[model samples]
Target: MRHLYIHVPFCARRCSYCDFAIAVRKRVPAARYVETIRREHALRREREPGWDTPLDTLYLGGGTPSLLPPGDLADLVTTFALNSDAEVTLEANPDDVTLDAAAAWSSCGVTRVSLGVQSFHAAVLEWMHRTHDVAAAERAVETLRAAGIGEVSLDLIFALPAGMEHDFRRDLERAIRLAPDHLAVYGLSVEPRTPLARWVARGRTVLGDDEQFAHEFLLAHEILTEAGFDHYEVSNYARRLPQGGSRRARHNWAYWNDAAYAGLGPSAHGFAEGIRRWNVREWVAYERAVARGNDPIEGKERLTPAQRALERVYLGLRTVAGIPAADLANPSSSRSFLAATDAGWLTTRAGRVYATPSGWLMLDALAAALTTSPEGG
Candidate 1:
């Protein structure tokens, strides 16, 4: 396996905009979850005997992975076979980060920490209901650095409510000043029936319009690129390593490259051998299923060839690596592809095709423009 992802689903409280499968309880079920994860790992290893699968990345993502004590995270790492220099990453809320916590993580082999800062602005943070204030978030970054965590990535949300009165440039500037090894700045989306969605539905909140969206998106591209960060993927940026390269999130890169990976724990998803699978979101049900020697997977599908091809085009366009020129320039989609080049939305260099910043803003259309029917017409 190229990567192993463990989903830690316990959170102190649900964020307003979150729709991830998580269990919010005052008393977290950390011990039970850790033991269950160990059992799941053993079961998985026994069923596959694939310990020989050399994993280069291990990502502990979640509702809140930093909620666990360092010991549990360490045990989880030992349970799997990992590369000597595997990039082990854990997602942490700002409030959970501390000098001691970071030291513990470093001691236990965690090489990266992704902090959920959301925003440095107080009102925006309030709207998101994040526990950590701007001061706390800033301190969290400093503390992680002081404890010697090699990489720290901050998460920021833009496109706030209409009257939120915050500047996107300010947020980007603050992020640059922090000099985090990585940054994930995403536009706020009100997913289905979450609290934010409900508020929007009731006309109690206003999501930014298209013009504001374009302004902020383009502004970030300019600012971040100027700051020497590589815009590696649509929403991700990586700092230039001292040795003259990017410290990109390898696990996430694996996903974009369509590499095989294992996903463990409730609500986790995995893609392997052309198959996509996911476990049940409910922890109790997932545990019972695993305990009874049943596969925790609630659903799975073998992607068709066409589906795979479509995913390749879509995902590739989302990154700086556009789909291969040869694959996309078939007779059928030639006109659309040529039109993009004519309009200065796409560019080709050396051998690979890449989307210009403007083209990236219209990724869905740009990717679709390269798709041809199975008959090659």
Candidate 2:
């Protein structure tokens, strides 16, 4: 099955720590944007007639997809044919999650809403330069629930420069009270060129030290697990469900499964038939290319077999389902797995290998150790 991701790159304002390819513009031409995306979708289908697989998942991610009007959203959703039970998700911010908006979204085929609620503390929100207050976050959750959108996910951030243990615990408790179906908790990292980095460079704010961050991460895992959320992925947790119930985000799982996916709009990426392509990041350039009837792709790369294998290992280890035990036993790959296992960061049982909770925290290092040169020279 194939998956689809539609990127909406317009935001009302940029967050201090965001480094994604997003445009903070005062005015947005949503109609024109959606039309261009529809054209791109049609063009891809025309080029690859065999790309007619039923879409198992559809994700509307952004700068702020919620910023688009309800009618525009419905038009975009109608452009694609999705599976009967496709996991359709929309990423929204608290300020945009009004009761009317939530109702409109549900009617437009959005079955899940991932709210960007970084923190419930006023200080944290201010420090992050988020537009919504704590009350707004709480109200948004209530509004979504009232609108009958139950499969909701709340996002939280920890490891702030001035955040204390008590603060982290309080934030987790506040989020749990909302009773969301899912939670995505992430650690704060000062990315290069972000506003946060600039502030740290000038001594306006300090960055959390490694020890403090690790402690906060471990605490978050312990608290959420105790609250009955399954630590399915490094940054994701979900309420325990009954047997054969839906427990994972289909769209995210598709990426881990290496399923074919088509991405539309500026800065979007697409992978099909071993060919990976990305559109130009500049909106004007992308629009111009599409207007001239030229492909909007800025670059493309064909993956070699070895490169694909490495990618499988790299992306697989980050999830709950680790590499198969048989694959790990290869002489070239066994050493890294064995080393990590010995360090108590990984465990092997039956035919499956998975990272321990600690292992997930250090996943990047573990994956790097597993990747080897093709020649083994």
Backbone clashes in each candidate structure, one number apiece? 0, 0
**For candidate 2, lDDT tens digit of each residue in 73-169?**
8899878887888888999999999989899999878999999999988878887888899999999999998898858999999888864223888
- Alpha-carbon lDDT, every model: 0.85, 0.83
Residue 50 CA displacement from its true place in model 1, Å: 2.5
TM-score of each: 0.96, 0.94
Tell me the tens digit of each residue's lDDT in model 1 across 217-280: 7888899989989998888999977688897899999898888888999999988889999999
| Regions of candidate 1 where Cα sits further than 4 Å from its true position | 331-333, 372-377
Q: What local lDDT does model 1 show for residue 367?
A: 74
